[model samples]
Target: MPRNSDLTPDKALAVKWINDNVAQLSRDHMTIWNLHEPSWREYKSSAWYVERLRAEGFDVEAGSGEMPTAFAAVWSNGDGPTIGGYAEYDAVPGASQDPVPRRQPRVGVNRHAAGHTDPHSALGMGSFTGFLAAKHVMERHGIKGRLKFFGEPAEKMCGSKPVHAAKGYYNDLDAAISFHPHSFPRLANSCFWDTHSAPYWSRIYTFECDNPETWQNAGAVTGVAHGHSAARAPGAIDAVCLMYTSSKYMKESMLPHHGSWSLNEFILHAGQAAADNIAPGLAQIQYSLRAPTLDMCARVFEVLDRNAEHCAAMTHSKVTANWITRTRAGLANHAMAEVTWRNFEAIGAPQWDEKARSFAREIQASLDIPPMEDPFTPEIQHLTAPWDGEKAFREQLPSWQTNLAADDYVDYTWHAPTVRLYVGRPTLRAPNPGYRYPEWTRHAMGGVPACIDPMWLTAGKVIATTILDLLSDGVSLDKAKSEFRERTGGGIGGTSWIAPLLPADFAPPVHYRWPEYVTTVRGQEWTIPTAAP
Candidate 1:
């Protein structure tokens, strides 16, 4: 715990405001958890944030960058540095769970309806609580600076940040703070050091059999009768199946299998209906690649394109590819990491009281395992140094690979000095060696206020303090900027700097058939129908 005398008056005010508003954070988190909007369609969640920020005296632009679910909110206290942070409200598909100890889907929704997996509900509220608390302190102290909070949806697809960066939404910031729930054990309660996130590139392939009538060996009969009687072309469904298998075979050869690279595909539209003689005309599949470098991503993409081409040719379909997102690898700023780490130490790691432990024990008992007295993992209640986390993060990687995993936050690091902060959310300890807990344990813990508030509330104080420090402590901010310039060869658009991978005029992939809730004659349900036809 930080002593009251250790903090300056402004910092104290920021901390106190966050402590007082804990109920508000809890309310907002539960509301978003219940909303559970998925990627590319966070309509209600986005509007809620926009309205709340506007009510809090910020100028908010809803539907930012031609993406209907994105927004930018800015509040300024006269002329000073501009600090940036964001909130992600988008949930993952197939993770729906109620805030209970056992397996139960959220009431009144499809069992497969989207749910807050990492519980971005807490992520958004934590950063939001910090931003608002900082704003309150700035107002009370007459501090001079600007605070920018962005409503970033579709993060599960790595969707919105690259678009925002390409369109210049992040260009004006002096620094940025990125926060996440500590989903990994190695990263608990620390800021990222040298090994930041890798690059993620996603693309969709569409195959069409529009010219099946012109296939070589079809009978001489005309359009309608020929389609049913003549030998039919293999068509788009075959193309999609072949593409999927071919890519699976080629994935091993995409790289040397050295670094932590991955290639995964999602079948968006299978294009098959009730069995009829006419061939299925259209199919679409999406490929998402994550690798340590852009060259690796490019090589994987080349093989995918070749597979698509061969599948289309063999199946007598024509294929076209569209980009979903292209993101750059992360560049680290040590100074920014250092600044955030000091603030984290002052705030201390989150403490789980007996109430939280009781919930974990209940979850364990429900899972048929006897619970320990302290059911939570040690890391959740303690802090890890940034350097230590970096070392642990690199355990599986080869010596030369610097970045690991993929996140859109990497885009922000190129724009300004950015720090990725992780505060531990609730996690239960394994009862025996190699025994894994079910997914509901995590989702349940994330939603329960008794279990989850400590993480977000601590995150709130850390972010508020860091924002105030950057606003008032010009020397520290300058050091961070200097490191960013040195790392990027002079900062944004310098000799070694990496620009936004997407073009300014690049269209957002809102038209894609992403999984979302729909209102049918039956009722509101997942695009995947709740009942059999």
Candidate 2:
């Protein structure tokens, strides 16, 4: 029998370190909240993380995976088993608000600028605390392991992680831990085991009718070709419209309504020069599809391709589709998930005190709902299993489905044995046991210190302790890896496992007309861009 060192002491130290540094983590979380950058434009937010990681003595790669906003930081202590901790710092575009109980957007910020809705500000900082805390204790105890921290941007777009996966960033990990703010009532204080996320592939299809002359000439209405002005082709605008309506009409039939799959379409660019209207030449439509399997995504894309082609041919235009992101469905390691959950149980769920409750009352009063002495129920503060809460709600979601929502973090599951952890975020108590809270109410609560800090701190403690578990105990790591190989068809490229969906040389959609801030005579600000007057 092999003699093993006690992990109980290391776990204790990691928890203490996280608790001791909660104030610092809170400050960092506030900084990221104020930055509030959206998608590929997270320059300030990304830079701040890089600076902080460098300060902590990790060998920093400023722009890993060819994404400007993404980074990888590595710290090794004589190297036993390598573990990965991931962070997502991107903000959602539509909503921007301050931390006040009332709804108020940030001042001196663009009216259309992004805000932390999933509140990735806390997500990143919370993970940051875990990464640093684990590293701190590992060094003190002479532990042997390598810790890798990755800064993943554009999580809202379901972007970044797939590219990193394709470029082989996660190829060498023994195990990984991923955390997100839990919005679902059922998954609080829980970690995912078997069913994981569905596959997500977002593509942009561009339709170009650069020359109506050809369309007119080809038609030749009277055997005498009509002039460009008189015989105008419907052009890109009609092509886009046809595709949109056609897809909406075909939505139900794309796949059997039996499974949980969704298709969302956005008009990215529609006619560059609408005023001129000499057959408005260019249009772009982005279709983001999510399904439980990649084969399902491919099947849906085939129909979409046919729709774009038919629409383009009808309008005498041509269409081209580009993959904005392609993430495979999640893989699971029961051992790894159990290990993470055990650490979470040791740490306990976030403890919300009177201050957080007081703030919840303020929000309730603002909503004109009578405030309760304790606004949040036990679900918000107590830890529960994935199967513990709201059976009726769980029943509505099909059991065969592992992932109801599409998130790019699922990409990591294929690379290494990973556990997806979810802890509770702030939610309104609601006027009644079943009343729904306003969107802005929950969004505002996410930014409030009292409402969100417990989550950040608790998540930090759990993540750090879990990392230490695998690092110190070879039995824990081997069990995780063994289960991973069994599930992933012998790891990465096993019989059933496939390579990353995107090709290695595939280009990042950096040039796409993503939303961002523009500098003008009034200095710098962010908003959805507008056409020139």
Candidate 3:
């Protein structure tokens, strides 16, 4: 058993490394627009990390699957068991912010806010901690085996799905470990199901009306005028209105609560070099649709196409429609979740009270927060049940029959065994006196070298220790796995489970394109775009 003292040196080193490197990491992660674009510089940053690992005597590989920043590093002591540690360093495009907040004089100028309050700078540091801990253990105890670190990019908006599919990254590892920062401290045993709210597809359509007389009459009669009306007298603008009204009916009729659908980006008279005399083109409009299943999504698209064709026929204008992009089916992987929960508990993280856990139940039950569903006095307490893997799996299996009496579609109960945990600085306020602050978070960020540095060191220690426990020979991986499963109420094959509300036969779409680029900025990926102009 490793004590807190066992991780002190590694943690100290990690905190130092992160504090020194955060600015560079933040810059790399926040600059990219798309992960698939070659312009993103995260690829280079990942390579830099790899070189650092090499200096530490680890074997490193880069450019996994054309994704520039995606890489793997390994330290092996003969051929024994293998353990993996993963880290994510992607940024949310719209969430860029400065390290600290600015006051009044700077308020109106879009001062840095909302970027990486969760500070993923800690991930790399944490991973480093794991790496060094393993190094120390191997050196001191003569433990022989392989410890691998994965620099995983683009997790905002669930980028991991594609990474998982493209690289088969997690498929062969004996076990994997990672962590994230959060407001509260508790292990997350339930992972969100990757179920798309509805299959929603989007299309952009442009219409041009060439009839001069009709164009002028329609615009004048409707009491609508364009700024550039004098240069182009084409009836294009009128045609756009006609299309808008036509699509509005279609939208209202198909609307389903939390179902599928949406329409936006209505651009009118957008073409340049078109003055008065009824411009040659009326307008361009973009419409989005969401549905519960692929079939329904397809049906919505067909309706959109038919609506466009009808608009074309009525306006006697050319109409061109094209699909923009389609997201994959939402995910709900019970098997992977089962494995995740087991690993979480085996790590000895604290658990939450069943009564308090009901907050999640409420969210699941409503499928949304309330004020949205206040009219019905549904059983709110039912939402708080702990996730039961066996129950969820049996219910999701193809052989299971739908039970109409139960609210299959309600999503009112815990559905999976996905866990999330937070380790904070010791300086943070404690809920009460009896509870000792974990010292974990506080010490990692505020100590002499700073608490963040040490936290990373501790992370490495935890990863190495956990991996050793899991992969050691005669260690009863199954028993350890079972113990974790039992904490979550059982494996997915058990009987007392409620089926997920998702449609049967749904499969998540697989993206085969390798990431064209990797951003290296600190924080969530979406924050990057917002951070800039």
- Structural similarity to truth (TM-score) of each candidate: 0.97, 0.93, 0.47
* Number of backbone collisions per candidate: 0, 1, 82
Per-residue lDDT of model 2, residues 1-533, tens digit only: 00113238887888788778777778888888878888888888899989988989999998788889899999999958888877788887768787777877666775566788988988887888888889999999998999999999888778989998999999988889889888667676687766677888898989998887766554545655545336787989899999999999998878878778889988878897646647878899999988987788999999999998999999989899888999988887778888888787777788777888898898888888899987886676777754353353357677766665688888899899998888888776667667887677777877778889988888888888888888876678899999888887788889878689898987778777787777877667665433321
Best by lDDT: 1
Q: What lDDT score goes with residue 484 in model 1?
A: 90
Error of 3 at 115 (Å): 3.5
Global Cα lDDT for candidate 2: 0.82
Better of 2 and 3 by lDDT: 2
Answer with 1 or 2, whichever has the higher TM-score: 1
Clashing pairs in 2: 517-526
Assess candidate 2 and give its TM-score to the true structure: 0.93
Candidate 3 residues 83-168, lDDT tens each?
66655555432233332111111122222322232344455555555555566556555667777776655443233323333334
Sort by lDDT, best first: 1, 2, 3
Q: CA lDDT of 60 in candidate 3?
A: 77
Q: How far is candidate 3 from the true structure (C-alpha RMSD, Å)?
A: 12.8
Whose TM-score is higher: candidate 2's or candidate 3's? Answer: 2
lDDT of 2 at 304: 93
